[model samples]
Target: MITENQIHSLAKRWEIDQITVMREYLQILFLFYLYAQRKSDKIFFKGGTAIRFLFGSFRFSEDLDFTGTLESDEIIGLFNNACSDLNREIPAVEMENFKKKRNSIVSRIRYTPKPDTYPLGIHLEISIRERPITKAASHIETLLPVSPYPVVTHLESEEIMAEKIRALLKRAKGRDLFDLWYLLTKEVKLNWDMVKKKMEFYNDAATLTDLVSAVKAFNQKKLFDDLAKFLPRAQRKTIPGLKENILEKLGRFAVT
Candidate 1:
């Protein structure tokens, strides 16, 4: 049960909406932060979670995602730690035996990480990532917007980094190609491989397939071409094999 007050209360801290921002705060802890924080050296939110700080909306998300560059066991420990800490604070977020892995089955740790009962019916989750260093453009940090309700301070850079892979997935094209046009060809380009490290919800097949579609859409619409005219195009084709690899996967809604 999610309530308007509780949701609104925390989101206000970051100058974001209770609906979108609050979900992000909770998502990071329960989903992946606990696992990453313990072992990883540096971890922060980057995807849609960052967008929410600037101009994010309240559309429901498939799950939460966080990114950091750390070994695998460390990532798992981060998830565990986050669960332990949150449950301690609120005392309602029960997270025991939260990890599961099999040969051909789902590898996930799904559980409630929020202590508040908002009455809004919003569940929280998180995804972790470690930014990769390659010969590419630097990632940009845009400011997020807050809801009409006022909080303590104005919208500022988040202490953590997370994103809305859910939106990116929905807006994908041929396979994993994201809607380049939608982002207006922003100066920053996402490193898919590093991003992959943090995203645990979807399997490699699902991630690649979705990414394939997103890129195809952008190319078809000449989104990159148009943006190249204005911006420096710092995000030049960085993700190797991304253009063709993910493009092979069909969209879930292809209606075979």
Candidate 2:
């Protein structure tokens, strides 16, 4: 484990809180374990955390989400073994309150580097409903110094964008909106077909009209409320006009 001083330096360099850096370190450790265990091939990493690490998104994530073919028992075992690896690396780390909730293995991962100090917690949600529709891609974990750097598996950027769009329509969370805007800023195009398929899974229709209506109807207050803790202080100022920004981008991108 890196020393507290090194962790602080990293936090300063990244312009985020020291605890967030520590949480990310824990995330890297688990990814390393997955790569080492050769289970990365079966589980595909997605969501905002993947965007932050894989594509350099400015926002941070609170949960590590994945979708794969592994059964709940297998996932629990994987998490237990990963917790062992995390404990070996950082003695203060503990995996607690694990529960299997209908097609998903959810748990809380807490890391306390020392006594009497606040622990950093990350929610782990692994959905085992299905496998990735696209071929898995690999990215080298560069945040921490893990020997033979872990080759993390994830879905293509377009596919991730598709899921984000689906999430926006289904949940309408602020983070999903921010992520969509960020992806657009990076020029990542949406896979319209994939978006339709994902929505269809919920028996919902996906069309430009529905997408526009949803974006227009977004509760500005709710968007900020959901994103309050997730976004950096500076980025929070941009939320007011975010809806218009997304609509403009969609206008250009959605033109058939």
The clash numbers for all candidates, in the given order, read 69, 0
- Best-fitting candidate, scored by TM-score: 2
TM-score per model over all chains: 0.39, 0.90
lDDT of 2 by residue, 1-256 (tens): 7678978887777667877777877787777786567565777888999898788888877888888777777777877788888788788888986787766778888887678888889889887765578766666556566566667778888888988999888888889988899998998976788888777777787887788898899998998898766666677888899999989998888532
lDDT of 2: 0.80
lDDT of candidates 1 onward, in order: 0.37, 0.80
Off by over 4 Å in 1: 1-22, 28-39, 42-46, 53-62, 67-69, 96-131, 134-182, 189-256
Badly placed stretches (over 4 Å) of model 2 are 141-143
